[model samples]
Target: MSTFGKHYRVTTYGESHGRSVGCIVDGCPPGLQLAEQDIQPQMTRRRPGQSALTTPRNEKDKVEIQSGTEFGVTLGSPIALRVLNEDQRPKDYGGGGENIDMFPRPSHADWTYLEKYGVKSSSGGGRSSARETIGRVAAGAIAEKYLKDAYGVEIVAYTNSVGPIELFPSTKEHPSPSTNPAFLDFLNKVTREEVDSFLPVRCPDEKVSQSMSDLIGEFRDREDSIGGTVTCVIRNCPAGLGEPCFDKLEATLGLAMMSLPATKGFEIGSGFGGTRIPGSTHNDAWIKTPAIAPGETKPNVKQPKLTTKTNHSGGIQGGISNGAHIYFNVAFKPPATIGQAQQTTGYDGTEGVLAAKGRHDPCVIPRAVPIVESMAAITVMDALMAQLSREAARDRLQQAGMTNPAMMTATGNGHA
Candidate 1:
């Protein structure tokens, strides 16, 4: 609810050791081409202290855009952005009222955000921090540069697995998923510069990315934290886009990845493993060729019936978009500010033995793969601007019945 797309909305504010975090987007699409060096590479890849397995708290999350652009383009208004919050320790996670701000850190959002807003923020875990997804990877990099400059649309994500060491691609070097190719031809040619050249832990195979970076360095040397799965794909997302039976496009992409911040789970396309097959092998059989792009004729190009040979409905079906290649999966948990030691109870109920501090991330799936490709490019660019406002209101009711013949008998033909 803290705003996300209805039309690429966004919203996000600040909190986790506050002073700055930021967002605001609001229905982008003006003169595109934005700046802040294109939202500082996904806010420096979802910022943290770079790497030693994350969270040493160096936060150089430099973004700024302080207003919908002017010279660098985009004046469709309401952009905002911002970053700051230097290295807000907030005494790690307790300082003000001690007892680690009176307990409650297990599986975070401290006691349901102080029982839904009676007061929370003991620094971090305020907006249920993962630094509140840095305004969703800075408004999903301007809704992925307006869905990759209007519909060449390509959103990639990685990490695929960690807690279980799954990167799938094996002739036996470390492959499993019935032995490689469960999904990956680099997910139809990967790129985010080849997932940052498998840096830190992006996991683009490399023998399961060195066994998922040696199991996140043995759970960051046992201070402990672990959880995984991030897969995303998207390809050229045009077709009918989505929206049916309640804004379905995988239910607004599982409500923009379960409104991120330790997202528990979500799946799409053959998800839940295609319920173990057999709807005649999961029925996606339709085959017509060339909808466009062969003869090079352009009268508002509309060739689009040739996508499925076998997409397992990941490119969405019935719920819309049948262009193909949509894929999904996001699981992320295991980051509730651990440093080990815990017995629980506080805020006056006694008990003791908390032993937590800060500088987290034993494994947040390589910074949650650009926040699941910026919440799937702000939920497929707000379902492709609600299918281009329903094809511009059906081409303005077919151009008002072909240029208003008799203007419907000059507006006096109701029952005359």
Candidate 2:
């Protein structure tokens, strides 16, 4: 199940320390403007050696468009993208020195991978490495472009918490949960550029970002690691973007986030914390409001579609979007490949010392920020495409004079 999405399918290939890592994106709408430049920003963001907080593996991770575009525009064909692995140091993971194959690192996929596949790559955890997320980030850039162009969807993710330090926005800053005007305002206006301007840790708050950086440095110096949370928000996503009965928007998002390496948890809207409040206090009450579209004129009248005064549901309800900001948190565990030595059983079941040798991040939250955004964009864009296809079919039926209630009822009841 490496492939994700129904309408906008993306299948990733290659692995860490492999010749290349890439993905083939199928079902992108035709006639959209696209180019290598459009996809490279995220590539650079997700690449290693960006700063001292991450692994020191120097890889430019330049992406090359292998096919599915002509004259800088998409051809509605499967878009093949590839990035060469020029700095692969397989030996760094004991490919020849100590032979990591003799023992599996704790909290890593080594044992499980061997059990599932009857074999495993001795170097860098193979497909389980965070390097595999490169393909996802690459394809997600394309999805982000299309979503922004079509629906003005803006996705932004930032380090919300690192270890025990959490960046809590002031209650005044976020206001009430029923109508989170401040939070909604921030999500609606924040951009990737704005988020990146925070740099190194990408926490947005300067003081907290510095603290997180210092904490990561401490772990790196100690040859240990820590885990944290990345919070993401999706703005301007049209209402009714989810498919029910299994393909729910939240369910798909949970699946997408969980698929990423080192992810431990996913929560949407109020998430687990919401349970603390009573249902009467937590429910999002509906209110009449006018649609707000830029550069488009509309009469100053209430919209036929109502909106929630509060967004405790996290912009989604009953597995469907409700035209509110969708916000969630992704929890990422620390990198398993630390320099610390630990006593562990070997492949032959003999006890031995395991000191992992490799270039790895002490805290993965900084790098995972972009990965979270990428996964969210891919999921939302796919759901949007599915919704559009259904709506187009309904429009065709209407245009053909087949949308009459009686006719629809008769046809559904098999009275053809």
Candidate 3:
């Protein structure tokens, strides 16, 4: 399970306190221009010590490409990436007066990890640490580059909420952000630059971003933590990118996002709010694609012949993409390794007060933005490659004069 994807496979290695952490990216198409600079920006964003609201652990998170490229072009082979763990502090977890070595941190992977393997790392959460995501971010950067160069796809994620503060709060009239005109408009146009402009919080909304920053500061000062949500959107994805049954596009997306550390919930499109509306109103109705004036279309991008009048289905239908924007929200729980002292049990079944020691964010939503975007890119890239393989096979069949008349008639309109 450490490896993901069918065509674009990524297998990550190393640990939190390990010498280095990284991944091996397999199946990337050859001849695309790539370099360390292309992957460094996202690594910088995901690294710790970004601002006062984040963990104090300082890591440059500098990435190095070990192989699979020559003269800045991929060789269609497995690419290895690595980032040194420069800020490791194993003694903080056990060597000091702290008893974390004896008791598993509450609500953390410490217990389940030991239970599953009957052993654990001397310090830190090992593979469960947020540091493990460095490899994922690096791999995602490669996938994202391919997606952009080949399909003009754009993936963006931002802090949607911190604690109870939200960019678009649900109300009596609008239980879902999908029902809000302003939310829809923002989704249609928000960019990564705009999202990053509001640093420390990354929520885009001026007033709300400031409020969320203050809220995170409050939690940090109290030696506590809070949970929040991240919203992501994938634009310009081609239609027919998902496989039906178990590998549905959204289902895979949910699997990717939920796999991240501390993620507790996942929902797509209208999400849970759609449950409040009736089926008649919740369903997305199809319509002819909107007409664009001459020169309005972006170069190298294709437009779908059909779209939805309402996107309550979230750009996906019947487990396949419909060439509309795909959006979803990922919920992260509060960081378990807080500075507060809690009454808990130890391995010997004894009761005591355990004051945890470590550097952790009071709120993980801000840094989670890039992680969400990266995971989205990986999922979309995998699905896209799968779809492309099928299309290529069908093309060969048609060119060989083996096309079925009934199938041709069924898809005569050329719609995916």
Candidate 4:
């Protein structure tokens, strides 16, 4: 489906070579300050032509707010946003002597797209293009704004690995970032400004970022592409946000991240590393909440009275948030459209060599950072709204004297 989220629904439209690409953000709460400037930073970060490491497709990706706001305030209606496709080169993928139109690019959506629809775009991957994510990023930015205003939620993502190189490579002694104190410290304090300071690669480590950049350059020079992993953290999230069973927080997060173009895998919290440890070693033990000073306020709204000594659960337990920092990693496969020749079958079932043409990124992890953060924001926002609705309904019932006596007794006995 082109649309996502139960509450905070976002519906995106347009194709890679279309006139424009954008999204409609529905179910936003009213009276929040918003403007084009609010959403442009993320859009700019996601745009191409940022450096030699990325695609040379020059697009400013400037967003225009078409409706659903008045005098900088959201009207609680669907807000439409649009960004024009200024540097379209549809002919590059077809026409002339280029045989790209005949053979489906290996590992691309070309074959499956045609097999599913019985038709395909002659120029690019059509709706499957990375350009389709522009709407997602825009919609995510709006959701992020609301989250930041209401709950002080902060979402940040950065390159964790490019090819075999990693910012914090796992060793036998430290198989996961959860086992490394330094990595935990970095998550606690790392900001978007610090992340962007190491641009082009966005690994946040000076030496590692340079290594990632050099690797991307090597692939670009060879007319090839590479893939990497992006790690994201959502902080100051309130407790009890996720739904149980089918819509568990991590399940929805997996769905959101995997829905992005080229995403190969998604893992949360301790992830795969936790599998190696015993249940006693891997579990997050609970502890008393740290005492606050007389004049100091709580660290954040809805701060839990008790906290976990460890975050092996990634801020979630039993599919519900635990008021801890939530972090996860998303793996993206290498871009399929390369300048190198490959032997493949064509539409007519004939064998041939296909060397694709188009402006494409050698390594997508840098630009993918913002896209990752945006998706996390959208997921959290949707979950938060759903939780808020349920809470309001329960509170109204209690005020109307409809509360169950057993439930009240259980709450009084601290069994809630």
TM-score of each: 0.37, 0.92, 0.97, 0.97
lDDT of 2 by residue, 240-325 (tens): 88999799999999999999999999988877767666789688889986656899743232233778877889989999998778
Clashes in predicted model 1: 3
Model 2 / residue 24 / CA error / Å: 0.6
Model 2, residue pairs in steric clash = 178-310
lDDT per residue as tens, model 1, 79-133:
9988989888797677754457878877787888788778877666768777878
Clashes of each: 3, 1, 0, 0
Q: What is the C-alpha lDDT of each candidate?
A: 0.79, 0.86, 0.91, 0.92
Write the candidate numbers in order of decreasing lDDT.
4, 3, 2, 1
Please state the error at residue 306 of candidate 3 in Å: 0.6
Report the lDDT of model 3 for residue 286. Answer: 82
Which ten-residue region of model 1 has the weakest summed lDDT?
A: 171-180
Writing each residue's lDDT as its tens digit, candidate 3 over 4-103 gives 8988999999889999999999999999899999999999999999999999999999999999999999999999999999999998889777799988
Model 2 ranges off by over 4 Å:
169-185, 291-304, 405-416
Candidate 1: residue 287 lDDT (0-100):
82
Provide the RMSD of all predictions against the true structure, rounded to 1 decimal.
18.2, 3.9, 1.8, 1.8
Instruction: Report clash pairs, candidate 1.
Output: 291-303, 291-304, 292-303
lDDT of 1 at 67: 90
